[model samples]
Target: MKPQTRFNRRDFLQTATAATAAGVFIGTSSASHAQDSPNERPVFATIGLRNQGWTITDKSTKFADFAAFADVDANVLGMINEKLEKKTGKKAEGYKDYREVLDRKDIDAVMIAAPDHWHTKISVEAMLAGKDVYCEKPLTLTIDEGKLIEKIVKQTGRVFQVGTMQRTENQHRFLKAIALIREGRIGEIRKVTCGINGATGSPVIPAIDPPEGLDWDMWLGPAPKVPYRAGTEMRRGYGGGVPLHTNCHYAWRNWYETSGGQMNDWGAHHVDIATWALDASETGPNKVTPVSYSLPVEYKDGYPTVSDQYNSPTKFEIHVNMPGDIPMIITSEGDNGILFEGTKGRFFVNRGRLAGKPIEDLETNPLPEDAVEKVYGGAVSENHTANFIEGMRSREQPISDVWTHNRMLETCHLANIAIRLGRELNWDPTKREIIGDDEANSFLSRESRKGYEINM
Candidate 1:
C-alpha cells in the first residue's frame, strides 16, 4: 500500500532542538521523552540480517521491539531469528525478501543493514511505505542516491538515522573529542588525518554454485548480477565463520560493486567525525585528489575490468581540499583513528580512546561542565537506537541527519572516483557537481539494473 505523505519534516527537526533549548525536560533522564503521556516504544523490523544487522538489532532491543527480520540468505535468516528470540524473547518473523517487511503496517521503523548497493533502494522504499529508517552507512552507493534520499525523507516526514553510530555511541569517546574541539582546546584548526585503514585485497576466488537456501538474485538487488565466488580461505574471529574470500559474505567489503571497501566502510565513521569537527557538515571540499593508492585489479573508465577478484583499492591516501582551506587526508597508513593538528594543540580519537596534549590538559584547563552534552545536543542516549527512538517520539531527525552525512560522504565517493580515474577532481559543492569534468560527473550516479529500480 502507498503510504500517506506529510511535509512536516522541517517542524520535526525543529521540535527536537527547539524544545531542548527551551528546557522542556525532554531527555533529562536517558529514557525520557517530551510528552507527558509517552507513546509505546516503536516497533522495529530489521532487513539484511547479516553481521551488522544483528548487531544493531541487539543494541536496539532496549528501545524498540522486533517484529520481523528479512534477509536473502535463508541460513542466516534462520540463525538470526533464533538468536533474536533468545535475546528478546520475541519470535520475529523471518523472510527472504525484504519487501514483505516494509509492507507490514505493524512495524514502525526499519533498521537496514543491507549490502551497500541495496542501502538507498531499501531506505527510500521503507520511507515511502510509512516506516522510519535507520540505515547502515555509508548510506548511498553514489552521490545522486544521497540526494534522492534527502528528497524522499523530507517528502515523507519520517525520522531517518544513518548507522554512523560514532555520532552517538562509541563509549562517548568521539563525543568528548568533538567537545574538546568545540571548547577550543585545540586552538585554530589546521589539518586533519583520518586513518581509516585500507581494504583487504583478494586472491582469485573460484566461482561456485549458489549456497543452499540463499536467494542470490535478491541479495544482488540493484547491483549487476555476477557469479557467487568463495574459496577455502577462512576468515576467523569475525562475522561468525563466513568465508574470508567469498564475494557474497564479509569479503563483499573488498568489492566496488557491493561496497566502497575501506574508503566508505571505515571512512564513513572517521571522516564523519573529521567533517563534524571541521564544521563542514553543511558544505564540502572543492577538490579531491588521489594522492596515492593501489587497486588489486585493472579498471577501464572507472569500472573494474575483471570479476572473481577484489577490485577496490587495497591501499589509499586521499587528499581533500576542505572548506576554509583545511587540508584533510583520508589515508590507510597510521593508527586507526582521527588525528587533529591545530595551531595550539592536537588530539587523536577513535572508538577506543581519545588522546593528545589537549586531552591531557583537561585536568587544569577543563571545558564547560556540559561540554559533551552540548556537542551532542543533549544528554547522550544509551545507544544510537535510543537516539533514533527519541527522534521518533519527538518527530525529529536523528543526530546523523541525511544532509550532513551526504556532505561528508561526497569526499569518500569523490576519492573513490578520483582513484578509479587516476586523477584529481574539481568539485562545485554549491552546485553539487564535478567542475568542467563531464566524465567525472557521470560517476556521481549509477544505473541500477532493470526491474530493481527504487520505488518512489
Candidate 2:
C-alpha cells in the first residue's frame, strides 16, 4: 500500500463539510429531539473507560446517556460499570472491543479516552460511522496521524474536539493574555519559551502472558508487537495490573509507541497555548532545530530516560522558527510554564501563577471585547465537554477543532521527529511535507496491524 500524503487545508475543509451534509452530523440541537422524541437519549459510547473516560462520562451525563462502554481490560470495564450504575442509577452495555461500539447506529457520539495509539483509529472510525468524537489529548500518535485525522474530521463533518482541556479553563488567564499579545498589548512578540518535561524510563521486567480478560493484541493496535512484560514500568508510572505491575496504564505516556512523552503530553497544553496566542493555530513552525538533547544516563526515579525501551526524548532544547517572527525555544525546564518575551517585557504563565513585568498590567490591560469573542468563538462554555455538546448542536467548531489541533500536534510531533532524526529539518506547512528527508517522512504514519486502515 502507498503511504498516504498529507491533505491541504482547503481539501480538508471541503471534505469535512461534505461529510457533515451527508447525514453524518446530527446537529447538537437536533440531538435532544432525536433522543427524547424517539424514546432515546443521544446515544453515546465511551472507549477506554478508565481515568479520563470516567470524568468525561460523568460530565456528559447532562447532554447524553452512557449507552455503551468499551475497554481492553475487563477489570477496567467492571469498575466503570459499577460506577455508572451507582451514579446514573442505570446500566450501560459494556464491550471489550471499541469497533463493536462504533458499529452501533444508535450511538451519536463517542468519547475516546484511550491511549495514544488508539486515538486516531477510533476517532477516524467513529467519524466514518457518522458519530461525533471527543478524543483525548495529544490527538494523534504521529504527525501523519494528525494530518489524517484533520482530513477525516473535515471530510466527515463530524464534530471533533481534541481533549486539550486548558483551553477551557477560566483561571488559566493565558487565553486572555494571548489575545492581548495578538492585539498588540505587548508590542511585537520576540520569543516564546514553552516549558515541557521529558519521558521517564520503564523498569526492566520479564515477558509474560496477557493479564486476565485483557485483549493484549487489541491494546497494541497499530503499534508493532512486543512480548508482554510483567511489572514493566510504562510511562506516567501507572501500573498495568499487579499493584507491583508498576507500568502500562497511566505510565504509557513515557513510551514513544504509546505516547509522545512530554512533547505531546504537555505540548498538547502549553504548545497549544503558544500557537493560539501567537495566532499560529492554523499553521506550525517552519523549522525545528534541536540545540541540545541528553538521554537518561541512569534510570533514576522521577527523571525521564532516553533508552530505546522508551521512544520519547528525556532532556532537549528545540528551537522552532515561527513564520515571520523570532524563533521560540521549547525546552524541558523553566518550571514547566509558558514564558513570553516581548519588546516591552516578558510575561510567564503556567497552571498556577501568571507573572511578568508590571504583572498587574494583565488584569488592567484587558483584551478588546472583539478579540475575546474571536478567541472563544462567541459562545463561552466553562466546561470542555459542554462545549462539545454545544458545538454538536450549533454545528460550529469546538475550541479544540481538528484544524487547530492538527497544527499543534504538528509542532510537538515535529519536535519528536527532529529529536529522533537527530537533525534539523524544514517543514512546508502548505504542502504538509517534510523537505528532502525521506527517512523523516517515513515516520509520519505507521502501518496498521490489519483490517484497521482509515478509509475516506
Candidate 3:
C-alpha cells in the first residue's frame, strides 16, 4: 500500500478512517515503533494513573495495547495495571517513575495525565525520548513552559496532541459552533463569554503525613515543596474518595503552586473553544483585566500571605481585550458554557447543549452537511484519542496543536496574573510579555525546583 502521504486532505481522511475501521497496520515502519501484527494496533503506555489517566488509556485500548503504566502513587500504579489486565486480558508492567515508561523502546506513544506541574517535564522528556505524546491540558504550568514544549515539538518532529477534547469531542457541538461562525450564520463576532466555574476557597486544614505507598516528594515534582494537608471532608464525584482539600489528587487544582485553579482548569477547555470560534487561536488578547475578583488568601507582593487555605480566586470576572476589538469575557458566574454574541445572532454551547436563534434558524436555512468537517479541517475523528491515533499514523499534528493552545491559554494565564497582582495588565502579544509591569512579567515563568527541573 502507498504511504498515505499522497492523499489530499479529503482523500487522506477517508483512507485513514477506513483503514482504522478495518484494523489495518500503517504509519511509521513497524521497526520504528512497537506494533502488534495480528491486531495491527500501536503499543501504548500511560503516565499518571489517576482519574483522567485511566480514562484516556481505557478509551485508547480500542486502538492500542497498554504496555506500561506509571504513577507516583504505588497503590494507583499497581491498581491501574491490574485493572488493565482484567479489562483487556493483557498483562502490563507498572512503575513509580514516568522515566521508566519513556525508557521503554517498545512503547510508541505515551498518554500523560499528570498534574499540571509535572506536565511539561514529563512531556519534554517523553518527546526527547522519541515518543509521540497525548498530554492533558493546560499543558504547561507557566507561559515559558508552553513555549518550551512548542520548541521541543518542532525540534523533535514528534506528533503531539493536547487533550482539549472539546475541539474534537462533545458530540461535535463545539465544532458546529465554530462552523456557524465560519459559515456566517452569526455575522461578525462582537463578544464571547466563557462561563467556566470559579475555584472554591479551601478551609485551612492541619498538615498531615503523606498517604501510604505514595512518594510525596516525587509527586511534588517541579512545584514548591509543601506539607500535605487534608480536610476532613472527602470528595464524592469524578475524583472522589480523596480528601477535598489536599495538596494532591482532586484538590491539586486549588493551589497556584501546582495548578492554575479554575482559570487554567476549566478555562483551558471553554476559553479554548471560544478562541477557536472567534478565529483567534493564533493570536492572543492585547490585555487581561480583573474586572472583579476575590482571592481566598491575602497577597503580599503577589505571593500568598497565608498558606493554609486556598490562594486561587474563589470568584472572578475577567475582561480580556482580544484582537478585532472583541471583548472576550471570562466569568466564574453564569451557566458553565460559552455564549457567542455576534452582529447577526447569538448562541450558547456547552457539553450538554447548543442552543440559540441561529441554531433554530438552521431548520429553515440549514448549514451544509459538511459544516462540522470543514470546521475540523477535514473528516472529524470519532473522538479526541482517535484524532491522536490518526496523527500518529499520518505523522501530522492533531486537532489541538500545542502552538494554538498556548496562544489562547496566554489569556487564561494572564487573567490569573492580573488577579494575583490586583491590576489590569497591558500585554504585547507579539512579544508575548506584559507590556510595562515588571512585577507581572515575573509571573510569566517559574523556576523549577533543582531536582525537578526539565531535562531540556
Candidate 4:
C-alpha cells in the first residue's frame, strides 16, 4: 500500500469526533524562517521546568536561545528563570501559564516537557501559533491524542520531534542495534521482550495546602480535581515535598489519571526502539492480550475506583501479536532492556550496554564500521536536540518524527488498555479501532475535563 503522504483535515475531523478539540483554531502560521546568518539561533520557550524538562532545556541551549519559560509552579518557574538568566546571560521572560509563552511571536519553537496529559494540548497550541515543537516521550496520554497530533502536524507543516533520545545518543548504540537487526544478523526475529521494569506503589497520603507560589488549580489543568498530597522524598528527588497535593515532577508517571505507569514511562523508550527494529513504525500489533497485571487500586471500565495512592498498575506482563505473526512481550519481570530472539541469534541492549552473540560476532565478522552511521542517515555526530534544531532550519523532519512515534505510542496505549480490561483485544490499525469490542474501542479516547478539551 502507498504510504499516507497527505491528510485531509475535513475527512479527519469527520471520523475523529472523540479526538476533536472544543473549538476550531484560526491562528495564522508563523512566517517562514529567514535564512540564518552565523551566530544567530532560533528563539524558543520551554513549557515545563522540572526534571526531564530542565535536562532537555539545558542541552537545547547549544542550538537555540531561551527566550521564554513557563510552568504551573511559580517557585519552580522562578528558579529556572534565574538559572537560565545567569547561564545564558539573557533574562528570559517567565510565565505561570503556558499560553502566555505560546502567544509570543518572537518565540519560534517550544519544548513541551509538561506532564503527559498536557503534552498534546500544549503541542497543538504551539504548532498552531507557528512554532516548531520538541515534546518529551510518551507523546500522548491516550490513543486519540496521537491521531489528533498527527492531523495538526499535517495541517501546520511544522517541524516536530518526540523526545525518544535513545535514537540519537549513546555513541549510536541503539542505531547500531537496529541496523544489525535489519541486516538479517538476527535472522528473522521470532520473539522480542521489552523489559521496561515496574511501576511504584505508595500508601495514600493525606492532602494539605499547596506550596507557596504554586498555582495548584492550574497545575491540575484538565485532570479531575483531587486534594493536594505532597511526597516524602528528598528535595533532590522527584517526589520530595511536604504532604500537600499530588506529587509532581517524576512521580507523576505512576498515576493513570496523569500518565501510563511503566507501560509508557519506559515503554516509551524500549518499545519505541523495538518497533523501529521491527520496521513497524507505521503499523502495529493486531492482537493485544494481557497475560497478567496488578493495579494499586481497583478499576472499573478503565477508571480507578479510588483517587488516592498511585493508581497505575504496579506489575504487569502483556503480549502483543504484531503484523507478521511476531510475538512481542512487554514485562516487568526482568532487567530494563530489550531482548530479541531470532532464528540466527539473540541480543540484549539497555542504556548502559549492548551485548549478545550477534554483537560479539560483529567484532570478528565486522559490520562495516560505517554501519551505525548509515542507520542515522549518515549524521552520527548530532545529538537528539541538535537534530531537532537543525531540522527546524532545514525544513526536514527530525530523526524521531511524530508519525512513527505516534504509531509506537499507540502500541503502548493498546497494551495498557488490555491490562486494564483484563482480556485480549483485536485491533484494526488502519481503521484505528478495536475490532468486535465496543468497550475496548471506548478506551481509545478519554473525555477531557470541561474547559480543558483539546481544540484541534
Candidate 5:
C-alpha cells in the first residue's frame, strides 16, 4: 500500500512552529485534532542519501513522514527522492546542503548518514534546532566529536540514537549473548576478542575532477581540502576508484581524514556490545596497546603521508586493558565475530549467529522470557529504527544512547590512535585524558576545517 503525503514541507514547518509555540501538546499523547494525531506521526528529513542513507530513509517511511532530504551529490539526492516518491507517493524537497534541512522548524527528527567527519556537526546542530537525531554508527570520527555530541544532546534534552543497532536489533543474538554474561551463565569473563575484519587500500592514484552533480567542496566538509583523484587510476581490490582519494562517499571510511576504517566501522558495533555486556559503558579501557599493525601508506606525525592510497591500518592486533582487569583484544584475524572467554563458558556472536556453551545451556536450562528484554532495559523493538521512534515519542533515550555510545567510540578511536602511533597508551577515563603521552593525546581530537567547526 502506498503512503499518502498529507502536508508539503513549508506547510508542515509552519504548522509545527505555531503548534510548538502554543504548546499544543504532541508526542505520546492523544490529540483531538487529526493533524496532531500519532497516526500522522513525526516528520523527518535525511542527510547523505547514499547506500546506507537510502536504506534507512526507506525503512523509516513506515514510522514517520520523510518531509525532505539532502545530499552533497545531487545525483544521489534526485535518485533517492524519485525512489521515495515512486514507492510511497510522498515526495521530499531536496537540498545540496544539510543546513537547509535544519533550518526548517517542522522537521521533528533527522536521520544522519553523512560521513564520520560530518556526523558530530550535523547531530549537534539538529539537537540545538530541537530535532531528535538518528545518526549512523561509528558515531564520530574522533573522540572529541563523541564528547561534543553527548554534551549537546544532554543540554538540549534531545533523543539521540547512535547506529549501534545491535543493542536493539540483531534478532536477539547480541542481547542473548549479553544476557548470558550478565546473568552469570558465563563465569567471570576473562577476555573478549572482537575480530572486525580488515581494510582495503589502493596504489597511488592521480588527481582528477569530481563527477558531475557532486558538490566536491561540501562533500569534503570538515576534512582538509586535497586534490580530487579519480579512483580509476588505482587497482580495484587494493584501493577503490574516485571518491576514494578525496574521501567522498564509499571510500571515505578508509581514510584517516574522514573515518577510522574497520576499527570504527565494525568496532563500533562489536566493541559497543562488549562494553554494554560488561556494564562499562560509562568507563572504557584504561590502557590500549597495539601489538602489531600495518598501514597502507606512510604517515608522518599521525597524518597520512600519501594522498592517493587508502591510508587506514589494514591489519592490527590490539590489546585493551579495561577497568575491571578485563583484557579485550581487537584483531582482524579469525571469523568476524566477538568471542567471550569466561571461566564457566564461552560463546561467539556476529550478525549471522550466536553460538557456544552458553547458547547450548539456554536450550536445556532455558532463560526466562525476559532475559533478552532485561538486556534491552525493558522491551525489544521490531528493529533498531523502531527504538528510535519510540524514544522520540516518550522523550526517553533509546537503547544505544549517545553517552554510552561515545564511550564505545572512545575505545575505537583510542585503538586507532594506538595503532597509528605503534605503541601503548594510557587513558584516564574519568578525566577523559591521555596519560603521560602528549604525542598520543594530541590524536584524541582534530581541528575541523574552518566554517565546519563544531560549536556549542
Candidate 6:
C-alpha cells in the first residue's frame, strides 16, 4: 500500500504550531512524571559495534539508552564500552555474541552494523524476537536474502528501517536534483549514469594464529572459513589498527564477497535516488543488461594477483529497462555523482553541488506543488532516523521502508550478478530467479555454515 496522505503545507504549518504549544504544556506537566517513569527512555542494544555502529548509537542517544553492546571482537567491544560510559555517564552491559543481546526482553530495538553477510540473519532473528531493527544499507547480502527480509518484516509487523540516510538529509543536493527531475524541471529522464569505480582483491599475507581475546570462528559467521592472515586485519579496521586495515575498512567498496563492489555501495545511494525520483519504488527495471566491463587480467601486492588484487570490475556499464519508454544506463564514471539526461537539458548532482547547462532554470521554475508533495508525501520530518522512530510509534511504514529498499537492492544485486556472470541475464522479479540459468540462480544465495540457515 502507498503511504497515507495527511495534510497540505498550510494545514501542516498550523497543526505544527498548535502541536508545539501543546507539547510545551505536556512537557511542563510530564517533567515530574518522566522522573518516575522507568520506561520513558527506550532501551536499545547495538550489534557489531564497529565503524558505523558507533555513529548509529550516537544518533539514537536522544531516543534511547545504550543498554547493551555486542561484538565478536573483544578489543572493539571494550572500546565501545568505554565510549558508551563516557557519553551516557552510565555503564552498558556487554556481550560477545549478538544472540545474547537479542534474548533480552527489555531491549526494545537493535542497531545492526555487521558485515554484509550477517545483515539478514541478525535482522531476521531480531524481528522474530519482537525487536525493532535499524540495519545498514544494501540491506542484504544477496537477492534471496533481500526477499526473505521483506517477507519477515511484513509478517512480524515490526518497524524495519534501512540506513539510507540520503533520504534524511534535507539539504542533500543529489535528492534535490531528483525532485527537480520528478518536477519535470529536467523533463523526462531518458538515461542516468552512476559511477562506482573499482573492485576488491585478496590481501597477500602469510596465515597466522588467531589473536588473543578474538573469536575467529564467530567473526567468520556464515561465510566460508579461511585461515587467519595479515589480510584478516583488513576485516575489522575500526580499532585504530595499521594502515592495511584502514584501506580495507574505507575501501570495502571494492570487494565482491564483502560488498557489492561499487555497484551496490555507491549504486545503492545514487541508483536509489534515481528510482525514487522516477517514482518506481514498487517496481523496478524488468531487464538488467551488462553492456561491457573491464577486470584486472594479475595480482599486485595484496591486490588481485591475477593482474590487480581487486576481483570486482574496475569499469563496467549496465542498462536497466524500466517500464514504459524510460530507460537508464548506470555506469562507473563521471566522478561519483548522478547525471540525468533529459529532453530539456542534462544535469549532474553529487553531495554538495548541482550543475548543468541550464541550472538557472530550476531557480525560476519551482517544482510543481503536486510533484513536491509526491516526493515528500506530506511528511514533516526529513531525518531518516526520526522517520524510523515515528514509524515505530505510529506503526507506519518508514520513508526507506524495507519493501521499497528491497526493490532497489534487487537492481543493485542484479548488476553485480550480471557482471560476475559476464553475460546479460534475464530476471523474473516476481519469481526472484534468473531465467533458465541454473548457475546464475545458484549464486542467489550462498551456502551458510551448518548452523546459519534462515528457515523463513
Candidate 2 per-residue lDDT over residues 1-456, each given as its tens digit: 001112344465455456457755432222323322434456789999878888888887887888899999999999999998898898789999888887776787899999998888888878877788899998888777876776666665666777888887747476666766766766888999999875554455466787788787778877767666556433243333343332356656767667877888898889888888777766678898988876534333322343334445678899999877567788986688888888877788887877876367747765566765556666457678878876666555577777778887888888878877678989998787789999888878777777556644
Relative to the true structure, candidate 3 reaches a TM of 0.92
Candidate 1, 1-456: lDDT as tens digits: 001112234544555457656755232112222222246777889998889999999998887789899999989899999998899787899888889988787788899998999999999888878778899999999999999998877666667889999998878889898888888888888999999887667788999888898888878889998988899877788774777888888878888888888998999999999998888887889999998999999999988888988888989889999989999999999999999998898989988888888878988988888888888877888888988887777666778888888999999999999999999999998889999999999989999988999876
Q: How many backbone clashes does candidate 1 have?
A: 0
TM-score comparison, 2 vs 4, better candidate: 4
Better of 3 and 4 by lDDT: 3
| Residue-by-residue lDDT tens digits, candidate 3, 319-392 | 99988989999999999999999999999999999999999999999889988887787898988988887777
State the displacement of the C-alpha of residue 19, model 5, in Å, after optimal TM-score superposition: 18
Model 4: which residue pairs collide? 21-454, 21-455, 228-244, 228-245, 229-244, 229-245, 229-246, 230-244, 233-240
Residues 1-456, candidate 4: write the lDDT tens digits: 112212343233333332223333223356324213324688888998877778898888878888899998887888788778777887688898888887787888899988998999999988888788999998998898888888787666677889999989976778888889868898999999999898668877656677788787777787778777765544444534433225555667778778898999899999988988887877888998899999888888877887778888889889999879999999998899999999999999989999999999987887877677667766564788888877676555678888778888888899989888888999898898899999988888877788887655
Residue 105, candidate 2: Cα error in Å is: 2.0
| Residue 120 C-alpha lDDT in model 5 | 87
Pairs of residues at least 3 apart in sequence or in different chains that clash in candidate 3: none
Question: What is the lDDT, from 0 to 100, of the residue 345 in candidate 5?
Answer: 80
Candidate 4, lDDT over the whole model: 0.80
lDDT of 5 by residue, 1-456 (tens): 001111222233354456556876333222222133455578889998887898788888887889899998888888899999998897999999888888787888889998888898899887777678899998888887777776665555566788787887768889888888878888999999999998767767677778899888888888898866655434354333334444565777888888889999999999988887777876888999999989999887777877777899899999999879999999999999899999998999999999887888877898888877777777788888888887666555677777778888888999999888878889999888899999998888899898778655
Against the hidden true structure, what lDDT does model 2 obtain? 0.73
Model 1 segments beyond 4 Å from truth? Answer: 1-37
Task: Tell me the lDDT of candidate 1.
Answer: 0.84
